[model samples]
Target chain A: MNRKRSVWFLTLFSLVAVVTVFYVSDRPSPFDGIQLFSDDTLDEVGLVETSSTNEESFVSKSNAFEEMRMEVTEKRSQLRDQLTTKVGSNEFTAEQKDEAYNQIEELVKIDSTEAMLELIIKSLGYDDALVRIEESDVFIDVVSNEQSTKKASEIIYQVKREWPEAYNVEVSFDGQ
Target chain B: MIGILVVAEGANDKRIQNSLIKTLSSVLQISPHRIVIEEMELEDK
Candidate 1:
């Protein structure tokens, strides 16, 4: 009788444990809720900030694209400065200086091209467009608030016409 | 070769999707399969 009782107790315990595991796994996590709430709050804050500005708000319409272009320009300037320093340094070999110069030149070219492409995209009615050139590939991110594939194709056609030697040009839209 | 990804609020709209694909194909001279469209909620600032 004792053995039978022990068996029944073990069965009940196992069942409870399995049920607990399933229940825990099925329940939504509190962290997920917190994250979602925080994201919503941030979005609200952004909206408020944009709305508060009357005059500057017009420029802020393409804030993302402007920020991206600024960042690229800053990076290009830094790279150029570094290349100049390296080339003038007597510690580095001629070959090293040449390589550094070549790399920096290539980077500057890409940066300039990206900036130009972004300007073209903006002129094509995608004011919030970003262009990034990596190696031979070009990536375009256009705000899709009023963007269409037709506008995207127009940008692509312009890129091809201007830079036919580019390896791959990829365009993506960023909604946020 | 250009790969296009369009993120729009109404990405599920059939008209937008069809027009985007058709435009990309004609302009890029590539198959419609090459252009990818994704939908996301974007907050306008």
Candidate 2:
């Protein structure tokens, strides 16, 4: 009985193997029609929709830009009116007036540090003193003969006390 | 008088600036419009 069972199991295994091979070899695979380089179906649909959406976006952005430009222009005109009125009513020292004019000219050039310094020095009446400029910063120091060393020191002290942004004023006393 | 510049960021900044100007005008005998105020928005980079 054991020998008969073993012969039946062998016959069943060989039959199953033969059937699987026949099934595999008989028909084309489901992936046979696919091509790696073919146009993607979903991307083509999205590309058409995206192009139309971009047109609308561009138009909306352009309108926004125009609105901003017009608003800025109106604001500028209003500011100019205010400035003119203020200038007419305000009273400034002669030095302040000169500095104001120089500042306007300097501001037009985008950078007027040198012109600003010149105006500052002249306004403070320190043009004759030695001026040192370093990296957008200015230092004022008095240079004089031995007899005037004390006077120079006093002037430096006075300047430091009076100016708002004065941090670099020095006076040499008798070369010491 | 020395120039005073105030820079602020966005609408909240404008509200704070307006409140400050109102208070200063009421207390310091200064005109509200005379203060130099500028507005700037924060940048990502």
Candidate 3:
């Protein structure tokens, strides 16, 4: 009877270990978690030449903003799916699961707010805009040839008005 | 804890950076040090 108990215990332990390994391997890296920008590789691209034609620059800026928006949307969706899985999985402790859900919720909220702000900016006559909300800070990028301080101020005002809780708001044009 | 990175299309401009920092600091009611503004050029794909 004692020998049979030890055998069963060892088998269960091994099964648990194998399952744990599989779970860990299948999970995405926490470092690769949620980001306002999905691809850090985009930062590696060199700056556009100042000598480039206005139209060409405008088109390029618009494209970049669009790509960034798409990335943000994709990442938000991915995070939501991960959150659902984490919540449903029995691997994490109750506290750990709650923390994971909260983090994902925060990311999704920020992403949604940023997307809404970007649309508002675009409707206000901006060609294209990218908005990233990290914690309490809000960053905005607008497609324009010149640095429009007036427009930037207006954006800041709009954001503050819409989301009074946002701690910081920074606005920049596409070109210097 | 808030960092804002803005990718622009042309040469870096100090004026824009300063203005952004100042505006963000004032509006957010946080010290300028708390707000980071990175201005990069947009890469064409």
Candidate 4:
């Protein structure tokens, strides 16, 4: 009985193996139907540039205002970090750390002052603006529909109102 | 000012923008021209 069963199993196994071999041996690749190099798909996809008429767009676009702001922030932050490192390092004396702390505080105050001035300028009716304070000079450039003397006067008035100091203020506008 | 800041986002338009800008200017004590509703991105809202 065992010998007869073994013979049947061998016959069935051989038959299944022969069928699978014939089924896949000469068949063209089934993936041939898929279009892997279609140009139409690429043509349908394109870049979408951000186009907005707000301060957000002014800051987001690859423009001078955003670049200037980012550069200022980067440089200030790097300076702040160096001061922080000096304050934290064990090699520094208490007096040195105190000086570093004072420098960091000054940096913070400068950053806050610049931000406040910028916000005030933006609130004063310009589309967007950047304010930079260097020692005794306060530099500002704004965007608006008209860059008249009257508009510049209004901006200077507002800037001085918020920041009352003897700093030499310079105002410029771009009617873009 | 933004329309979405006052009313529903989908209902924002030119009229709504003008209205919202005035409202924002008055509330924030800022000039209307300083606030551009059209240039404000929805995601930034």
Candidate 5:
């Protein structure tokens, strides 16, 4: 009778264990919310990804635009240098250069010879501007103080002798 | 000696009735009363 009771108890315990295992496995488990993303959430994630991609593309395009601008500026500078060099080398006739320069000068609005001379002197840093107008020929004297007197006189003499149209350079220490 | 009296850049423009005097004096080679220098006034740049 004791052995039969022990067998009955073991069978009951095994059956309870099997039933618990099957119930736990078959029933829906509690979700930790990790894998519970809805379709709307998925769509939001997709939109975020797309926005990031677009931002990246925008950055790339901005960079490309900057590169193109730099290239264009460089090309323009190169062309200006080439043209200035050609004009200086007498590739263009005096009249032709003068006419072209006058057109550009008018468009850009350079009125005074002094300003033009200053620009010419400044441009000597990079390249010379083929002087279209003879400053000394047009002006009798360059107004200069004691400091710039010598330079002014030198330019005057040079221009007076260089251009046949200019007979003399009347230089004065004062701008009268 | 009729010379044109002109103004200086930094100084005021002094127009002399007898311009030849100032012109000759400024030129220094000729007598002031003998030469004439035309006076042209351009605005300061």
Candidate 6:
């Protein structure tokens, strides 16, 4: 009768252990809150992300003019730095130094000329203006209501009167 | 001379008294008598 009691006790202990293991394994994981969140909350998160993206896009689009100017300025700055370094270093001869200095002066003159032209365009009743002069090209961008071939021709004539270099003049109108 | 000789841009526009020209003159903040606003004519090629 003692042997029979020992066997019954061992069987009862194993059954209890197996039941406890199954109970723990069948429970929901701690990270199951994904299902607990409402659909409204997820939609709100998506809307916030979308709105922020739109705001960034608008800012970038509106700053196109400024971005162009900044790029030009940055390029000029780098070129000027290189020229200045060339002038100060002994690797360049006197003639080379003089040439670099003249290039620097020419860059200054180009900046002033573009600025003056832009001012004149503004004085001409344009809302805003930008003038960019490359070696063989002239770019004139104006904010105005009228964008006509006649107006373009007149702008080219006016620019040629001032600069008079055989430049390929291109005129752009921004009605915004 | 204390005169402001201004040239309007992009050819001459024939307006009925040119309200824009008058507006330009008014905004200059100068004596009306000392302002000369002229619209540049496109030269015949």
True contacts kept of each: 0.00, 0.00, 0.00, 0.00, 0.00, 0.00
lDDT of 1 by residue, A42-72 (tens): 8767543554454344445456455455455
So what's the TM-score on candidate 5?
Answer: 0.26
Estimate, for each residue in B16-40, the C-alpha lDDT of model 1 and write its tens digit: 5556666766787654555677778
Best by DockQ: 3
User: What does candidate 6 score on TM?
Assistant: 0.50
Candidate 3 residue pairs that clash: A174-B8, A174-B9
Is 5 or 6 the stronger prediction by lDDT? 6
**Best-fitting candidate, measured by TM-score?**
6
- Write down the C-alpha DockQ for each prediction: 0.02, 0.03, 0.05, 0.01, 0.01, 0.01
DockQ of 6: 0.01
**TM-score of predicted structure 6, chain A:** 0.62
Candidate 2: give the clashing pairs.
none
Model 3 per-residue lDDT tens digits across residues A1-176: 99999999999999999999988889766675455355664676667766557777676676666556545554565566677789999999999899988988787677677768878988988877888887778888888667767878988998987777789888878672
lDDT of each: 0.70, 0.48, 0.71, 0.70, 0.45, 0.70
Q: Chain A alone, TM-score for each of the models? A: 0.56, 0.27, 0.60, 0.59, 0.30, 0.62
**lDDT by residue for model 5 over B1-45, one digit each (tens)?**
333344434322122323334344556643333333344567684
Ranking by TM-score: 6, 3, 4, 1, 5, 2
B1-45: candidate 4 lDDT, tens digit per residue: 322234446423344555566577678865444454543447866
Lowest summed lDDT across 10 adjacent residues in model 1 chain A is found at A52-61
Judged by DockQ cut-offs, is candidate 2 incorrect, acceptable, medium or high?
incorrect
Q: Write the per-residue lDDT of candidate 6 for residues A26-101, one digit (tens) a residue.
A: 9877776776597866776754334675555444433565546545654675687688899999999999999999
lDDT of 3 by residue, B1-45 (tens): 445444544324444554565576568654444444455645584
After superposing candidate 5, which stretches have Cα over 4 Å from the reference?
A1-50, A99-176, B1-45
Best by lDDT: 3
- Return the lDDT, model 2, position A24: 80
Say which docking band candidate 5 falls in. incorrect
| Interface RMSD (one decimal) of model 2 | 8.5
Considering the two chains of model 6, state its CAPRI-style docking category.
incorrect
TM-scores, all candidates, are: 0.47, 0.24, 0.50, 0.49, 0.26, 0.50
